[model samples]
Structures are given as C-alpha cells and as structure tokens.
Target: MANTPSAKKAARKIARRTLINKTRRSRVRTFLRKVEEAILSGDHEAARAAFKVAEPELARAAAKGVIHKNTASRKISRLSSRVKAVGAA
Candidate 1:
C-alpha cells in the first residue's frame, strides 16, 4: 500500500536491502557453523582456520548493520577462546 511514488521507491529499496542482508547473514552463519563443526571435530588447525575466516565475516556483518557490534565481538571472542582451548588441550 505504498501510495506515494517515494514510498513505492522506498519499498523497492527495502526489498533489495533485505535480500542482500539475508544473504550476508546466511554467509556469516555458514562461516560460524564451519568453525563450530571444526571445533566439534577436535581439529585444531581446521578450527583455527575457520575462526580466521569467520572473524572477519562477523565483523563485516556488524559493519554492514546485519548484526550488532557487541554481538559480533562476543561471538568472535568466544570462538577464538574455544579455538585456543582446543590448541592447548
């Protein structure tokens, strides 16, 4: 029900932004899941590598407003800790 032309344009913009954000979110989740899977498998090298890949993706997601900054930091912190623990063990 976008009556105004501006509103209609905004709706279109929103739809496009939503699709891009969804894809970014999905990519971030996939990276995080890869880290988790590597951790669960007790593969230190793989876990470390996945963490390296996921950390930037999480940060980028935050920067793009797909996720909050603190949440991204917390996730990266926890995953890095877990990876370190695995290395130590």
Candidate 2:
C-alpha cells in the first residue's frame, strides 16, 4: 500500500511504465518469432528480412531499458548466425 501522496503517484507512474514496457517486450518477441518462423519454414529471404526488422526492434527495446544490453547483443549474435546458416544452406 502506498501511504504518502507521493508514493501513490509513484505507484501510478510505475503501473503505467509497466504497461508500456510490457507492450515493448511483446512487440520485440513478436518480431523475434517472425524471424524464427521464417527460419524454421526454410525461407532464407524471409528470415533475413525478418532479422533485419527484428534487429532494430531489439536494439530499441534494449535502449529503452526493456531488456539488458548484453541480452540484446547475444540474441542478435545468435540470430545472425542462424540467418547466415540459412542462407548458406
């Protein structure tokens, strides 16, 4: 429970921020899923295109603090490798 007025306001702010962050996270996941689906379906061009879109989304989410910087980097690295392999195959 928030006792002070300031605390109550902060709680409200936090709730709003939480919703925004959740939205951002979901958007990022959707983009990643698109890439994964393209990869699994063996569409190299689609996968590469999805990755291109997802990379910037992931970077933006990280920049906004929705996810960790290292986490975003790791995902980008792994996905890039998989996308490259798809192209090679």
Candidate 3:
C-alpha cells in the first residue's frame, strides 16, 4: 500500500533495518545463552569468560537500538552477580 515514491523507499529501509535488528537480536541471545550454559554447568571461569563476551554484545545491541540501555545494564548486572555466585558456590 506504499504507493508514493517516498513511502516505498521508507518501506524498503524499514525492511532492511528489520533484518539487521533481527540478526543483532539473535546474536545477543546467542551470547547470553553461552553465559547461561556456562553458569548452569557450574564452571565459574567459563561463566566469567562467557559473561565478558556477552556483556559487550548486550551493550552493543542496546547502543544500536535493538534493546534498551537499562535492560542491557540490568542483564549485565544480574549475569555478573550470578557468575560471581558460581565462584562462591
């Protein structure tokens, strides 16, 4: 239904952006999942390493507008705390 040239162009841009966002989101999830797996496996060092990698990916996704800044911060905080607990346990 985007008949006008400008609207058609906008639609195309949105489609492209949607794909990019989708990929970014998937990458973030994969990183987080790695951290989770490490934590669940009770490997404190591996959890720390995975968290190190995942934290930045979450922040990058937030910076790129795939997720909110607060959400990313919260996730990083919780993951770090859990990673610490894994070491303590």
Candidate 4:
C-alpha cells in the first residue's frame, strides 16, 4: 500500500513509534499495578512506596502524550487518597 518512498518511510516510523509507546504504556501500567497490589494487600508502607514510583511514571506518560493529563491527575489523586486511608487504618 505504501508504494512511494516517503510513504514507506512514514510507515516504518509509525511502527517504531508504536513500539516505543507500547513499552512506555506497559511500564506505566506495571507501576500502577504495583500500587494497586500493595493497596489490596493492606500494606500502607508498600502502597506509599509504589505510589511514589507510579506518580512520576503516570505524570511522565501524560507529559509524553501517552495519556491525558487530567486522567493521570485523577488516578494519582484517587490512589493517594486510598493510600492515606490505608495508613489511617
């Protein structure tokens, strides 16, 4: 389909960007999952640590255009509240 040289090059660039974005998204998910797991296990300290790690990853992903800024902010706020609740308990 991409017969022209420019088109072909564009396709290749798209493929490379897709792979990089996928990796970044996956890394962000992994960090979030760690926080969730720690929260579920009721380990406040671990949850806090995971939140510390995940917050930056989420912010970076948003900054890089991998996700929306508000979405990232909402996630961080909710997770922080949950972590606080765990600590209070």
True-vs-predicted CA distance for residue 45, candidate 1, Å: 0.4
Worst lDDT run of 10 residues, candidate 3, spans 53-62
lDDT of each: 0.97, 0.98, 0.97, 0.97
Model 3 Cα RMSD, Å? 0.4
For residues 1-89, write the lDDT of model 3, one tens digit per residue.
89999999999999999999999999999999999999999999999999999998999999999999999999999999999999999
Stretches of candidate 2 exceeding 4 Å from the true structure: none
TM-scores, one per candidate: 0.98, 0.99, 0.99, 0.96
Q: What is the TM-score (0 to 1) of candidate 1?
A: 0.98
Q: Local error of candidate 2 at 89, Å?
A: 1.0
Tell me the spans in candidate 1 whose CA falls farther than 4 Å from its real position.
none
Clash counts for all predictions: 0, 0, 0, 0
lDDT of 2 by residue, 11-88 (tens): 999999999999999999999999999999988999999999999999999999999999999999999999999999
- In model 3, the clashing pairs are none
- Ranking of models by TM-score: 3, 2, 1, 4
Global CA lDDT computed for model 4:
0.97
